[model samples]
Target: MTSHGTTTEECSPTPPTAEPATPSPGLYNADLAPTARKGRTWRSYSIFTLWANDVHSLGNYAFAIGLFALGLGGWQILLALGLGGVFLFLLLNLSGFMGEKTGVPFPVMSRIAFGIRGAQIPALVRGAVAVAWFGIQTYLASVVLRVLIVAVAPGTASWDTNRFLGLSTLGWISFLALWAVQMVIVSYGMELIRKYEAFAGPIILITMASLAIWMFGKAGGSIAWSTPATKTGFDMWRQIVGGASLWVAIYGTFVLNFCDFTRNAVSRRAIVRGNFFGIPLNMLLFGAIVVVLAGAQFKIDGKVIESPADIVKTVPDTFLLVLACLALLVLTVAVNLMANFVAPIYALSNLFPRVLDFRRAGLVSGVVGLVILPWNMYNSPAVISYFLGGLGALLGPLFGIVMADYWLVRRSRVDVPSLYSDRPGGPYHYARGVNVRAVVALVPTAAAALLMAFVPAFHAVSDFSWFIGAGLGVVVYLLVADRKGPFAEASGEAIAVPSKR
Candidate 1:
């Protein structure tokens, strides 16, 4: 039987070539999709740099410290982190493979799953996710600056009581200051983001290393992880699960949007190798430093310090304090540019291709970031939990559907030319230009995930929220989809990946 004006036999052939690299003036933007660019010179280090850019932040550091509070000793925490990191690597590469194979950005690649015009649904949602995170990360990055300003001037502490929009006068200044520095980095664009990540990744690692060493030196000898909780059986396992969930949430934003980088990768092999070193291995090393820092905090101050700036403040040496603060500033700025800055540029560019480019979109994104009043939202642990967990719930379905359609139903045979076409009979222009099956599956599953996140009763199962949503989305989409629609595939076939166009 035919579906959507196409026969099953006819739908299983190789996809046609996409439009020319140069986008048309109306709705096509060069930055919105992959161009005719060929292979890249990027190596595994670039992947490492990307992870560094994504993870070397106050947010990640705080998350690491939180893991220790989960009733796990240092050794057990390390094991949980390693397991989570390995899974995270696998999840990332799934999305990365699509871009590497297709040479398209995430939104453009999404056309196959959601339809050319319908792709806007996922694009807008993902874009909004970027905005929220961009704001949150900006606020987190500025925390170091806030610590620095108060320390240097001393009287700046008064601004905390005399506040603007719940942020201190000094807080506002520091936030804006780092925000400006981030935009300056954005103005220089992706090359600078790449170069900065490559350069700053090592510096941040070294800084963390130095801090860890200093902490160990002053920790008064042996190091061991001890928390207040008395977790032994299921309780310990629950903590491990919770730690893994946090680990997933830490990099969850990137799993679906990773194509923003992998599409430009030198090879699939490089992507894998880089992720191995950059994520799981890097997490091991970075988490060790964080563990040590937390241990030292307990030794010296009788409390676990999660905030890097606060930890630095405890240092008596003037030079080390200033150096740590500066290193943090650089780290924060680098992360803000790499993770938060690049995705929104492409996302907004997709909406108004004729009107806005990456730079303009970036400027607009910063404005949106400020408008969200992220300052008020970011400080609370409950808010952070909801923010990251809730967003991950939404992202879970999107990622699941995309991966399901690409790898299973489509058999990787994405019709590139059809990704841009909105004609009634075009490959992706299903049911009035949207894939109703995908949306139907996405809504219910995503709602289920959201309920797990926000509802007080369901919070116990919140650790598996992303997994639940994604798994349900995948199963439902495959079951509901028309075999002759975009999901059509021949048995034992693989999507014939066209080389760099």
Candidate 2:
């Protein structure tokens, strides 16, 4: 999510403090604090590349095609995906500015609304959600490796014929190998991740564009758009809404976690500008390509191919198949390391501040993700729906709470020092380490949303759970919030982080 907010130094005064320990070591670990006022240097292009960083994965591609399974035509699916992209861009911009303005990560920014210590609740919530997707995405990435291995070494096909604990022997080998590859990249930290995206984004786009063009040519450059997927004449609107909602659910968690990325941007406009192209434009383009590819599959193969790996599997040219898999492998590794791995590391760090720095937190997150066997959870539509919807259920309320706190309650001013200070009665100090009100608001809202997600009878409403839960969170938080504070008005220190020497 590309969010909006002036960093604390940009718009709010520095609260009472000792020099903040330079980078705020330990209790106010500098890594977790508002970035230094003079250090914001990320530009618009950097922001645009983020979607490429996050979306260039097998799952994102499959998800685009899955939208068409709703029985909508290419045009309808495009519209829905584009609109969902717009919603994502807007929602992310709403949150992104706060990170830029405040120059702090999501959990740190949540202090005002959830309270300093209480902020951990949302942090852990997002972290757990990240872990789920992290493992799931990691598993999804390994599919490319599986394809590459089988394409090159046909004898390994027997591994697919056999099974153990939900995956075959070769599958297990590929998964662990891919997992290790990701761990290696993540260990190098964000700077390297940044460089990886910059390098891989263009190549991935070119490769997918080539595949789509090739498929379109084979299909005779024409597409027979499908009829309404779920309903007849007038009720087609419902199908479109359902499709759009699914896209939103896929997008829900990112907006909530966007602060982790936006905090690194040097200028507020950089994120917003990047988001304009990144979310709506990029999704439409990618979705169109996938829709065409799916449509082409009917002519080129037989049925709509669910996975691109299937497309690569059919390629008669060994060299071309290997090349496609290589692009995909690069894409998947980048997505796992950048999208799923980063936020969870921060979440875990927030959870055990003194004990777990980012590296240690990455170890903890990676370990937990491995134990969950995310592969078992990722392969089926029903399972994916339930899994992603459940995640959205948690995300919606957090998005609402944070948005409400930043936009309505605090009015954008934050006591930056108090966010890190251990002093009692500090601006964010509430109850004993937890803000009961935010909990009160988050629990039932999320519970109802979760039921909507997993309960078959309520499943029809599951896609909209994010929207509904967010509305509920806003109402509940508004009712319990303090009537006034420093953040009550939109006033603060105005200084940009200077360029680093």
Candidate 3:
């Protein structure tokens, strides 16, 4: 929506080229290529559902309970979630703008800031994080499968006694089954993903609502709004901040790539409206449901159960069993593909455009995720938090630098071809193929955030590390980077419409 440099002026049209009208998809190729002019309004709906699938799931529920466990009251936890969602909404809008402007994926867009060759740094950072999450989500889905299997075939629980590679035979089978389901869905690419999300999101929402209702009934109208027993005193604020930080970290990873979907939007307005409904409103509502359900569980079961599978296991009705299994299976697959699979596929493909196509990149990501065995990764909360903190720290600086360059430095224009061109005179080319000022700002800010993550003395700072890193990056780049003279001219050229796609 924001135009950067000079506007295009029609000239006495030259004869069209004799070559075939079908241009090569080039470096920005995707399974769902964005149209030069948008048409799909359904895409806005699909994206809205995408966020719903993201927020109305096991991970989201667990995160809410985790916040409550921090000693924060329901109101405080809701406030934290609301604040985190506000940040997420704004970040997504910026990232979405990039996609709409460039019609490129996250990795391709990084070329502006990181240089064409150097773009791999952000790609690898995003890809590695995706792979880690992929494995963890896969393991979680497998746990759901194991539950269903034992529910149907009661003797299958005996397999738990015979362990291999730190898991039972049943666990391995369940894990593989879940892995296979996700791989199959993702292999179909974005169209299938869109359809899957549209359906799965509603089903998951319905099941969660039903579960919440049933949980309330089981609690005998005595579900008091009480904080988790584990938290105490000022530690409640500490916990609330920690929960907010984790929420930001989760959303920040994908914020960079949000434009991948937004590029297909009918208009920037659609993207904004979708984000408003999907992020803050949806997350807050889901958080409220989670809090109510968690409180109900505490009253009914004598403890808080974060996992939906764990909560559903307490239900006795045979009819409910069928619905719960179906809901969990569909929801897990949806989240795994949307949140973890797609981004990494694009990230890896960007690393080597010619050889590694989207499908190959997806396979590579899946294999790497298998290597991590992320069930082990999520075993330690502190380690998981630290890892998330490190990734989140990078996001702020990256966002700051990219947004500043596009909005302030370049105005709004982007040279699409030059983004892929590797020659010396290319718009993105810089000395030694990296922006030193951006790096200088990014590195120290990330270091500061990481220090906060690991050091108990810096605990207060840790909660706001993303903001700190991002703000510092913006300030440092603005001050140190040569914004006057020749550099300013180059910045203008980068965005000017020399030609149109």
Q: Model 2: C-alpha RMSD to truth?
A: 3.7
- Please give the TM-score that candidate 1 achieves against the real structure: 0.88
State the RMSD for candidate 3: 5.1
Q: Cα lDDT of all candidates, in order?
A: 0.72, 0.73, 0.70
Model 2 TM-score, all chains together: 0.89
Clashing pairs in 1: none
Winner by TM-score between candidate 2 and candidate 1: 2
lDDT of 2 by residue, 402-445 (tens): 89878887666665665665656555667855677787888877
Query: Candidates 1 and 3: which is better by TM-score?
Result: 1
lDDT of 1 by residue, 94-155 (tens): 87766665556777877788876677777777777777777877787677777776667778
Q: Which stretches of candidate 1 lie over 4 Å from their true place?
A: 1-27, 37-41, 150-161, 228-230, 379-389, 485-501
**Maximum-lDDT candidate:** 2
- Clashes in predicted model 2: 28
Name model 2 segments beyond 4 Å from true.
1-26, 155-166, 227-232, 300-302, 379-391, 488-501
Where's the lowest-lDDT run of ten residues in candidate 3?
A: 5-14
